[model samples]
Target: MQHPAVPELAHTHTRPIHWVATATAIAGVVALSSLLQPKPATAAQSATPDAKPAPTTAPSTADVDFPLDCGPEQALVVKKATGDLDGDGTPETVAVVHCDAPMGTPPDGVYVLTHNPGHTHARVVATLIDPKARNTVTGLTVTDGAVLATLLGYSTADVPSCCPDVKDSARWQWKDNTFVRSTPAGARSI
Candidate 1:
């Protein structure tokens, strides 16, 4: 039955073309939306007059003279890890260094290096393991504001330099404006 008030609407009938057109328009909208995505949100706050920007780069091990007296040989950084060890915004580098020796195993010194915001060179802030300890750092890492290391040492002076008889695990954490050393576990004979 046709009503006099409104003629039969042609668009009211479902057609294949109408479906195709509607689907294409929806696809175009989705594609456009993907390309117009908003920038990712960051927790970083905008720079203020008194606020100092956090350091982006960690301290470098190269060129920084360590406290170890290598004498004629050069100091070599064997392993290094970087992290925010002092709860400061800036990161520090934990380096396992030893003298470049051509022969027997050389003792390693673990040092913490920090670079000042505007400084070009990094300076050694703390010495975790002194070379005089006659220990070799087998593994070094900085995690959760703590410096961890596996050290190999001689049981006595009679122990040959080529071989270490004792194995020890060490951890250092920043506390009270100083790095405090703690033996996490008991040393074992290797």
Candidate 2:
């Protein structure tokens, strides 16, 4: 027969329950961490309206005049003038001048002129190049009574030489009660 002390010792040596409790606590911690983790952003949250369009600047018409040396031999006459280049209700003028030199020559070439009121001044816009021949003027148009003239010069690949490529354009509009450069098309105001 087992002694009374043997029964007591058996009860005292119960399997350690700490390992099961520890495993359960570790599982809970893992689940909580997964629930708190960051999530991917959605389209609505990522989208923002920060970009904006640029404001347009009006052209200046302080000094308006055609060059003195403008002729078939030296300058180009107004070839086809339509839609008020000066923005006056009257039709605008256009001219196509021929050069005595070749395509790549640095002679005065084609141009368009917008006459100012009182016949006092004329705005002369032209396409020209330096010593190296290259198309310097690209966009030549009239908008809202202003003459927009663009000058796009030689490109590095176009000119093998080290000449600087100059790209610029001008706009003419009326200002100070004078037909400076800003005149809406088809309306003549001297």
Candidate 3:
């Protein structure tokens, strides 16, 4: 056979030591690249220093002590809706709360809650329905900065608490620094 012009290469045959050295070099490159990543990119600019930060989150109902005397039972939130009710940029929460009764129907109390951006606790701004009225909220919603509710009430004191004899649809709007309540129509007997 004719003599080859070039000699055989040593790396053509990979030994255990060659594999170990190659693995170490690859690991080193990966570790070095991870430590040299670029900063994250953003599209929006930062806010001005003096302007008030827009409130992002609506107030929560937890830890809010509603104006209701449950006696031995605690106040429980059944339904809630959030919206900007007072024409303010920040949103407010409307909560329907009632006593945690084990037996009969308990009257519900509807309250409006507002919390400043940095405040720790949310305060009650308005009480739409008091528990003393003995009314149960069948449906509640906040739409177009208005609080609308379907209320179930009694026609007279003789009516039993278990059965409400009157059904009314009520709407409350913020006007003149107070919530003005107006009924779309007269209460109907159920």
Write the residue-wise lDDT of candidate 3 on 1-190 in tens digits: 9877999888889899999999999999999999999978789566788766777678999888789999999999999999999887889999999999999989999999998446677888899999999999999999999999999999899999988989999999999999999998664557
- Over 72-189, each residue of candidate 2 has an lDDT whose tens digit, in order, gives 4443332333345434445444333333443443322334544444444455554322212443334456566555545444445655333436555555554553344332353221
Q: State the C-alpha lDDT per candidate.
A: 0.88, 0.44, 0.91
- Per-residue C-alpha lDDT of model 1 across residues 52-130, encoded as one tens digit per residue: 6676789888789899888899999999999999997789999999999988888999989998556778999899999
Higher-TM-score candidate of 1 and 2: 1
Best by lDDT: 3
Which ranges in model 2 have alpha carbons more than 4 Å from their true place? Answer: 1-81, 85-87, 94-98, 107-135, 153-164, 177-190
RMSD of candidates 1 onward, in order: 11.7, 19.9, 14.9
TM-score per prediction, in order, is 0.70, 0.33, 0.70
User: Total clashing residue pairs per candidate?
Assistant: 0, 35, 0
Residue 56 accuracy (lDDT) in model 2: 25
Q: Which 10 consecutive residues of model 3 have the lowest summed lDDT?
A: 44-53
